[model samples]
Target: MRASHAYFLFVGTLLTAAGYGATFLLTEHFRALGGSEIDTSTTLGGAMAGTLIGVPLVGWYAKKLKAARMGAMGAVSVAAGYGFLALLTTLTPLIALAGFLIGLGWGIFYLAGPMALSERVTDQDRGFWFTRFGAFQMAGIGFSPIVAAALVEHLGLSTRGAFGVIAGATLVAAVLLLTFEALSPQASQARAQTSNWMRALPALLSSRAIYPILMVGLGACVFSGMLTFQSSLVRGTGLEAGTFFAAYAVTVVVARFVLAPMINRADGDRASVVLLALMILGVVTAFGLVYGVPVQIASAILLGLGYGLVYTVIQTQAVNDAPPEHRSAALTWFVIAYFFGIFGFPVLGGWLIVTVGIAGFLAAVLAFAVAEMALALLRGRQTTRKPVSA
Candidate 1:
């Protein structure tokens, strides 16, 4: 890789870490300001919304702004969002505004940074590079709670103080991202052209692409549910809620570091079967957690492995199958499947939890996993009958 590209990767890693840390830290800080559960949920919802909506907008405007400029703006928003929170004593209403701004900033950074990475790396290196990107992200997120725990314990810091730390980290990340050279105007325009929504949608919805999207959407449902309710699920286990996050994070990091490459190399059919089967096992194990801690930890590890591999495989397929011109939109839609899962799964899980207690939630997750596996098998048959050039 070029030195400039390497710089982008380094900075990209930093920016990802900062963005995630801000999410974890700021949520805790927001609670300190008398923010409600509703506020927290909305904030996360807004961030997801921003990412879903912002990718398309960013795709449209890639020609107008350099990645560095976008990175700076994103960082500034993180700072301003957290800064606003610091000023508020109670933030129920204003929390939405904060969510919007923070989400927008986070969304911009999320989309632009990866696009830049994809631009810099060669085709042969794309999977490996993106895996590394995922690793840094996993590390950043995994490390955040530890950092937050330490800051709170050692520094006698308030929740707002932690936000300051998160904000500062993002600001530094933004600066690092800015040091990379800008893509030429022509190159930017070309990428934008490739991502044009008008031309891309129909092609993407073609019969060949539809099955992959379905498979991805199914996997995303499992993932989305976990992100939304894993904390709550851990809390439900009657273990110290505080410790659950630590265990979950550690398990995720282990899965990402150890299994991602192997999963990435698997054929789509083999990967699909394995991924969903693992997810089913994970949820079943998580259900067993209500009975013991060992089960809970096992569930966490299984879910982490299942999710980590499924995401990598689905994402790889999304990019590999799409025409070059539609690559960006393809990714955007691929992520949309993920966001839909994030948005929808929690609500369903919430209802299930109410109806069947903890077991209901696990049952629902297992059901989704099984159904996804079934769909994957059907698609596998189709893929066998009519192979596409990958």
Candidate 2:
């Protein structure tokens, strides 16, 4: 793997750190501005809605754009959003525009980052780079809040000032992306893949390669909803939310090193079943945490063990099974499905909470999970029968 590839990805992702972190801050920002909870959700949802348009474009243009170039484009979008936010004093509809731009860049940057890594290294070394990819992403997420908090608390930096700093950093990242040489001509075209994703969409979705990621939609929904709404919910069960999440993140990172290799050794079909069962176990067990802290800790560990490798397994399956020429497009589709779960179901979950209560919401999540398992089983059967060549 090229060191440059890793470096560029780390820097590229770092540029978006504030955008992701801003969502959390935006809630309080909106509240401080006298906006209702509904206003916050709507504003945030507007950002997520950008993925609806952005992801599909990424998928369609996967063949045309260099990953680094795409990342550069994303960086600019995010920086623009940051700049716009930095200039804001009062609430305005323009925040949605800024949010939308950021969201667009989010999809494009992620799509580019993975493909760039793929281009930089040999297949034998792909796992190392992919793991690193997650590490960098996690590092950005983990670092952003800490840094932003420090800036606010110690340096007396306003949120706008913090965003300005981030915006400057993002522009530098974009410059680096525009000038990078990691992607060769062939890689630039993803080996000259098909030009029309619209025609290919139907087959891509029907293919067994897409099945694992489809199941991931369910998992992403749970992850998104939990973090967005229920970050505090576990506290009611006698678990400190921070402690539980810290445990979850630690186990996830650790499992990538210790457990992901085993999943990789296993074929995609079997891997999906393993991941699905583990997530099911973890989520169900989480509800039982009212019994004790032991259960809380156990659930966190199990969830980390399960969800940690879930994406890796499905992502590997999707890329490996995709035609090499169209792999970028396939991965984009996979990512879109992921965002759908993250953005779509979380809102639905919120509605479910209001209508059916937490009990009903939990029931719905479980049912959705069961449906994912059934689909996984069906896909597993088909994939095992007709093994895909890597």
Candidate 3:
């Protein structure tokens, strides 16, 4: 691999891990401030909703400036948002304001980095590269919770202190991102010249690559519902709500590093089908968690494995067919789809938990997984019929 690719990948991992830490700290910090479970879920959902607002902005900015510049702005926003979070003791509007900045930074980092990485690899290698990227990206997601939890426990720091730590990490990630020469001079000029936002949308919307990508996004919706509310689902199982998130994060880490590599090494279509099936199983395991802790951990592990593979496959397939100039647009649109799922599902999960309880919430999430499984199957068959070169 090229030095720039390695650097971009490292920066992406650091950013992802920091983002994961901030996400955990925010949930715990809000709750510590006497926010209700419903309120906490809503705030998290709303913060994610802010990303929906920011993605189009990043997509637009990518047209005019180098992605590195946007990424730097994103990192600064992440640190400033977390710094603001550290200063506030009350359940103030600052939390919400900070959320918007956090969302914007996340969108820019995600949109810019992957596309830059993809540019360096060939079509036949895109799947492998995306999996490697996801693996590294998820390494951050998997490990940050343990580190953050240790920070909170060992330092006797306030939740805001933890938030500050996350902020510092994000700033370092942003600085690292800014130093890398990931974008080619020619590619940078191409992005700078293509300034019209509307023009990019049509081709993204028209691609044959969209079906499987849609499945990835929708599958993520299922994962979001579980993440936002699984604590509530695991509540009556004699495990503390805090333990649920810890377990969830740990399982996610293991699956990304362990199970995902083996699955990705297999055929992509067959592996995806298996992963979605595992997801359906995970959703079901969640329903069983209402009964006990063993089942809850099982649910976490299953879902983690399922989540680890689904996007890796979808992302691998999404960029495999697109030409280099169009690859950024393709990845941007795929992210738009992923963000839609991330944005929509939590609010719905909160409502479901409030209204139907754990069974109702898992049932609804299961439906999403089942639908995704069906889509993966159909897409697999169709892809086979056409014999895509990649």
**Count of clashes, each model:** 1, 0, 0
Write candidate 1's Cα lDDT for 90-144 as tens digits. 7766765666667667666666666666666666786666666776666665566
CA lDDT of every candidate: 0.63, 0.65, 0.66
List residue ranges in candidate 2 displaced over 4 A.
14-18, 21-26, 59-65, 86-92, 146-169, 182-195, 232-245, 285-299, 320-328, 353-358, 385-390
Candidate 2 matches the true fold with a TM-score of 0.81
State TM-scores per candidate: 0.82, 0.81, 0.82
* Steric clash pairs (candidate 2): none
* Model 1 ranges off by over 4 Å: 1-8, 21-36, 182-194, 236-258, 323-325, 343-364, 385-390
Instruction: Point to the candidate with the largest lDDT.
Output: 3
Model 1 lowest lDDT segment of ten: 184-193
Ranking by TM-score: 1, 3, 2
Whichever of 1 and 3 has more lDDT, that candidate is: 3
